[model samples]
Target: MLGILGLDELTERVYRELIHLGPSSVEALALRLSLDRDRVHRSVQMLEAKALASRNAVGQVQTAPPQLALGALLTAQRHALGQAELTAAALAEAYHSASTRSMHDLVEVAVGADQVRQRFEHIQLSAETELLALVQSTPEVVEPGQSFAEEEAVRRGVHYRVVIERPMLEEPGAMESVLGEVLGPERIRVVESVSTRVLIADRGTVMLPLTESPQVAEREGRRLDEVGEPMALVSRAPGLVTAMLGLFEYVWQRAVPVRLADDGLDAASADSAPTTLDLRILSLLLVGSTDAAIAKQLGLGLRTVQRRVAHMMELAGVTTRLQLGWQAHERGWLS
Candidate 1:
């Protein structure tokens, strides 16, 4: 058989003898095989190199057990395997937690105007110590029963600081009166500009329309016409929440404190008047209401509104809506 594989017959014989007897000294092995001691020793060395056998000191030879350990090998393998499984489970858990945070931490679409109002109510109700808000209006365009919610929130003793457009201060209504009675003169601050509406609650959360097109309208009976996706250019990350909070601080710094009864003439007149048309255009822009809406609200033609806004933008030296809003506030025209 060894001849067919091209191996020496003595080499084959030594291999068979080692299998029958587990371990043996070189002299005993040589006596049993009837081969010279040197030849037996050489055969053992070849078997050991092939990993079929092993040698001990004092010239004893033994059959090498299988490379695989039974229980102990399995235990070591399982310990390594268990570590990998635990690591994978941890990574999966972390991914799931991050997905949940992304979904819950930011603004989302509310179903209806009523639903939007409800969300605002919920935010107001959830306030702990203070509420700082920047929006187009002071009283806010609340549905019928929201006043009760505001009253309930006020009763809880939350400090409310707000910045609003000048027209909202002039509007005659129970809503305006209610704000005056509750928040008092000290809490209300007003600024002027043309931009989208933004409302911040307790310096933690913010609400802004994500739509780039002004044509997209909140359809009747549909509160959420679209999703409130986070601004990609701006960091909505938690680490930058303080930066957004800083924006409110900057606006608050430039805003003027006022009471509904005060004519705002004192503040408005403190600086030289920017021509009546400039004041009108600047006021409309600050409220986040569009040019057409402002024209309709002020009873002017659309073209006139557009021309006036263009003129105001050129005069104010601002390139973007956000900057325009901030500039209008800084100039104290919206107040």
Candidate 2:
């Protein structure tokens, strides 16, 4: 563990035993630790060079106080890390600026996985109201349950409106990440499929991927096959953002809210609007079509049609199809 502080294993062991033994000679340390005297002597010398150990006139080695010595080492490491962070931030800004043709434009295309990941995280941290996203399985920057910024945003009470493609939550670490303390089922809905990955922060800005990148491919150890580098289009352009927002809504309505905390229909069913398929099925039923007929017309399985009809009946608190139709009319479901 002390290797990170520049202490080799033997050196750290020697120092720790020195502290325990309290003023041990090299010979005594070697005999007690079953190490050669010369190796113990060398480690003690190294410890002394680092000011972590001292020898008395009689050549008995003793460790420096643990608190003082380790605190100094840790503080120096932290300072170095802080400097590196600043340098990295500068480098990242340069990378992003280089990728964009004009920083003044409302929309700019940026290359590199790092830039895209940074924006993905930065938007979460910057959100003050709602944050919306459609997540996919691959080309992931932030792994599931690893988005610290998202956890912070959730803690800030920012409402999340997120949709995950059906396969995404089945991927490894996906359930833990999306269902971890950072996110709950209440904020997430499942879609049959989503082709594009998107993020809309506060509905004011949208980020969309444009291509796979060599940087990401190499990082993931995948063959690039001469594929173009990963790139993302970020936009604050009102028309583009609005169109993206509309698309999000369209998909969101068709998606099914999920709940696995208990055995029952999704609690979201109480508040969520009827899905597009649900509306189409209800419409066909009201027009006096049989379940099989509706199924064939909608390209759904016959059993799927029956199941949906039963679910609608439950939602309407009625046991019969006729009552369900009457309830649908009362609720303005056709509209």
Candidate 3:
């Protein structure tokens, strides 16, 4: 029980023997503890230093009162703890400094769904400025009741911009729920396809899948989904994060804006008339500009260009890009 007071095993045993024997000599303690006399003498000297024991002028050892000795030990322990706390703080600062100096060291791999989710939640909670993501068709990462953290982040004025695959948004009531509870429709977009999943925060950190290729899975005679456990790579390298931000910008530009009914665009009017962005996209399309070229010409994102084109095609009741171009000309939309 008193080991917490910095007493070693032998010291505690000798101290206990001293208390039990009451003013016993080192020889008596050694005999009682079945320890060597020299070892008991050393323990007695240590106890004396702690003010727990004293040697009389006749050379016999005497123990201080239990209250006095225990109190002194407690005081010593508190002082040691204060010193340890200061040392720990200094060490933590040094470690943080060293970590900042090495960007490569900031990259980490998390395995298993739970670990990935935990890392994702940590990043979401820590985000202060902006969060950008491209979500593909994957297993759901956010479990029920866990979205409160994201809601808190949004309440703190953190901007969230997400581009989701169109098919994922097509789930029953998913779009409405996301718009109403998670993020506004203006900050979200949908794309026909996404190559990979990605998440970026404040242009400083990124998380992406760490998966094996189909060839490897085939060689192992395993289906893609059952090949191995899921993993994610998280990195805080400035250069790598910057490149990811560029990719997100390219995809965001080409994605179609998801306007809700309350945003002032009725289905009837949307089917008949084009939005300003849609008109710009039509003008670019009429000039024979590819999606990438249109995005570059108008300083829009590639995904935005593609999304507007798709929206225009839907409005014109055309099934193909070429047919939409012909419809635009026939309806005097090109003029």
Candidate 3 backbone collisions, by pair: 253-301, 253-303, 253-304, 254-301, 254-302, 254-303, 254-304, 255-303, 255-304
Top of the candidates by TM-score: 3
What TM-score, computed on C-alpha atoms, does each candidate reach?
0.44, 0.45, 0.47
Where model 2 places Cα greater than 4 Å from the true spot, the runs are 1-105, 171-174, 213-223, 260-335
Candidate 3 Cα errors over 4 Å, as ranges: 1-105, 143-146, 178-180, 212-226, 261-335
Model 2 — which ten-residue stretch has the worst lDDT?
Answer: 259-268
Worst 10 residues of 1 by lDDT: 227-236
Candidate 3 shows a clash count of 9
> Between candidates 1 and 3, which one is better according to TM-score?
3
Screening candidate 2 with a backbone cut-off below 3 angstroms (N, C-alpha, C), the clashing residue pairs are: 145-177, 212-230, 213-229, 213-230, 214-229
Instruction: Tell me the tens digit of each residue's lDDT in model 2 across 267-297.
Output: 2354355555676567556545577776665
TM-score of 1: 0.44
Q: What is the lDDT of candidate 1?
A: 0.59
Q: Candidate 1: which stretches are off by over 4 Å?
A: 1-87, 94-116, 137-147, 169-180, 194-196, 201-239, 261-335
TM-score of 3: 0.47
Q: What are the root-mean-square deviations of the candidates from the true structure over C-alphas?
A: 11.8, 23.3, 15.1
